[model samples]
Target: MQEPSDVLVLAERHGDVLTLTLNRPDQFNALSEAMLDALQAQFDGCRDDTGLRVVVLAARGRAFCAGHDLKQMRTHEGDADYYRDLFARCGRLMQSIVGCPVPVIARVHGTATAAGCQLVASCDLAVAADTARFAVSGINVGLFCSTPAVALTRNVSLKNAFEMLVTGQFISAAQAVERGLVNHAVPDDQLDQAVSGLVDAIVAKSPLAVRIGKAMVYRQLGMPLPQAYEYAAGVMAENMLTDDVSEGIDAFMQKRPAQFRGK
Candidate 1:
């Protein structure tokens, strides 16, 4: 059962971009059941909306997120079924972010540990504050961050992800970029600005092209090299048949900006 809170997550829309901010600052915006449900609901809404071009996952307060609410987890004690259901729900939310048509950019401005770090990894892209730190530190409490490891390994090298999980050590934002965990790390004050830069660039492109490309990128990653190429080639061929692609090529030749209607 979720604890009652009017705004576990705050949603703000500016034109075509939707920003979802975690609001439980006092608790380091920990992913309580309520918070997860709030986030899941928001992503579900985005799935069907063609007008939405981008989603920025941000947080309020000092820490972006500290991970799961240990207090809530503690309440369940040794209930194995409860834990399984919880993790399953969390997994579905992460998958939803990946499957979203519009890109989800993690705007990390503070500490993101354990599942918090997993949230960042699940996004299509991320920009972090230079001072922000990340870790999969559930090992410190004698528990392995198995779920986070799944996302971590996909984003970063196996050795690096294993080290974080085993050692429970923190990595600075710049190091995160080096490890391919985040795209850019800017000064703390410029975090939101960097996120907006990505948002602006994405929203300017053809919505249909972006949607198709995002889905193709993830799907191809799971295929064998030759099969991946074949899949991509088919996707590109179909993409070329769209009016947006035709307009893009015409605009390039005509020396004019493309007026992509997302057709």
Candidate 2:
């Protein structure tokens, strides 16, 4: 029940990368109201960080996140207004991750269930430990994970997403990767290394190109096939006008390392 500023989420900066760790290990890093607020604030801060190349959403405890703080929810019991606000706030947080200019990568070590799974799905990329597990298990408690389903369905096939929602069954990290919930699943000890690899690759790219590409990819996902192509073509043309793209092309032609200013 700590305040949002009391380290419900910890923001650590290393060069151009920001690592935001869920700090509620004792509660399995549950997304309490404070935690959600803290996470949103951190992502908001990233919005204007032009030098930032990547963001890693990680957790400190045995579980990555155990969805919402059920104890906190139970305390409010039949407060429909509170529930609506809570879910809306959470939805905004998830959207912020998607709308991030730089890629948001989830470094998942343990279980990520319910809304926690939604968090992973919302990230641009995710790398999980081989021992990690995932589920949208709200149904087990007689509450369907309706909000989580929005993200889950986007990341995986509808059938698989529906099965997870209805069955409330846990899937292994390997299964998660197979279903496209995560990019890679490595041994537990290699989790950090795996995440570092992704971070390094992204940091080496032109920041502007990465930003444009991330935004374009998400924006086009909901478009019709023809409209998506039309939109992407326009975005690509716009990207071609950037100084970074010019540098990239010239470097390729000259067979030299590209020095992108991210312009």
TM-score of each: 0.97, 0.97
lDDT of 2 at 145: 100
What C-alpha lDDT values do all the predictions have?
A: 0.94, 0.95
The TM-score between candidate 1 and the true structure equals 0.97
Model 2 per-residue lDDT tens digits across residues 17-109: 999999988999999999999899999998999889999999997999999999999999999999999999999999999988999999998
CA shift at 135, candidate 2, in angstroms?
0.7
- Clash number for every model? 0, 0
Compute the lDDT for candidate 1.
0.94
CA RMSD (A), model 2: 2.0
lDDT of 1 by residue, 1-263 (tens): 54424589988899999999999999999999999999999999999998999999999899988999999999999999999999999999999999999899999987999999999999999999999999999999999999999999999999999999999999999999999999999998887788888898998899999999999999999999999999999999999999999999999999999999999
Give candidate 2 regions above 4 Å deviation: 1-5
